[model samples]
Target: EDLWVEIQANTFKNWVNEHLRESGMQVTDFHDDFCDGTYLCALVEGLQKRPLKPSWNKRPANQHHYLENATTALNAIEADGVKLVNIGNVDIVNGNVKLIL
Candidate 1:
């Protein structure tokens, strides 16, 4: 039942600003008015049947490229003899979280 820290909408804006600062990515602002109204969404997925499998070091997403990345990572995780859970839907195994979503 390990869930990610659900960052407040306003605070999350500041978080990325601070973290991505050294990454050289121009993270403008995380405010609604500034971002044209966008919120954070985290997709939690793991082994559905077995559930004991460990997820990829990378994270998952519900969006386009990220979703594709999730699929690839999941496939590799599965092939590694681990189980899986849903990324968006409820996970019946391994536990997951959708924080700040």
Candidate 2:
């Protein structure tokens, strides 16, 4: 199961990097790369091809700021007609690998 999860996570990372190439952003590790929510926001923006409402903080300083950024990303994602069940900003900010993938 661990190996399968790793492979799935790597696939997602590759997919994110592909979409974010134009933006010059990359997802190195699904678990650690999204801890601050910067890359996650970028990925969502790339996917939506639009800016997020209530813009996210480019440079998050604390946990609260990270959560805010994640919230913006998740909300924008949902706004784009993608339903995320049982996942929230806290999960992203906390770097929950399972939920993130």
Candidate 3:
């Protein structure tokens, strides 16, 4: 089970790196990288190939800002027809790797 999780995590990390290559961003640790939501926003933008909602917190200093960014990313994802279930901004901010993936 742990190996399976690790494989999935690595696959996601590589996928994120692939999309974010031109942006000079990389995902080493899912928990820490996506915790602040900034990296997640970048990932979403890279995937969508466009700018996300302008409401994103470019500099998230507190939990509220982090949640805002995560919300924006999740909203964009849903707008792109991705159905997210059992996860929310708090889950992303809290570094829930399983749910975040």
Candidate 1 on 1-101: residue-level lDDT in tens? 22333344435546645544443443333322111111111112222323222333233333443434444444554676866543421221212223212
Which segments of model 3 are wrong by more than 4 Å? none
Per residue, candidate 3 scores C-alpha lDDT tens digits across 6-75 of 9999998888899889778888999998988989899889889899986677778999899999999999
Candidate order, lDDT descending: 3, 2, 1
lDDT of every predicted structure (CA atoms): 0.34, 0.87, 0.89
Error of 3 at 41 (Å): 0.6
Model 1 spans with C-alpha error above 4 angstroms: 1-7, 26-64, 70-101
C-alpha lDDT of candidate 1 relative to the true structure: 0.34
Angstrom error at residue 50, model 2: 1.3
Q: Candidates 1 and 3: which is better by lDDT?
A: 3
lDDT of 2 by residue, 1-101 (tens): 89988998989888889998988888888777798888988888887888788888888899998989998998888877889999998888788898998
The TM-scores of all predictions, comma-separated, are: 0.28, 0.94, 0.94
* True-structure RMSD, every candidate: 11.6, 1.0, 1.0
What's the residue-level lDDT of 1 in candidate 1? 21
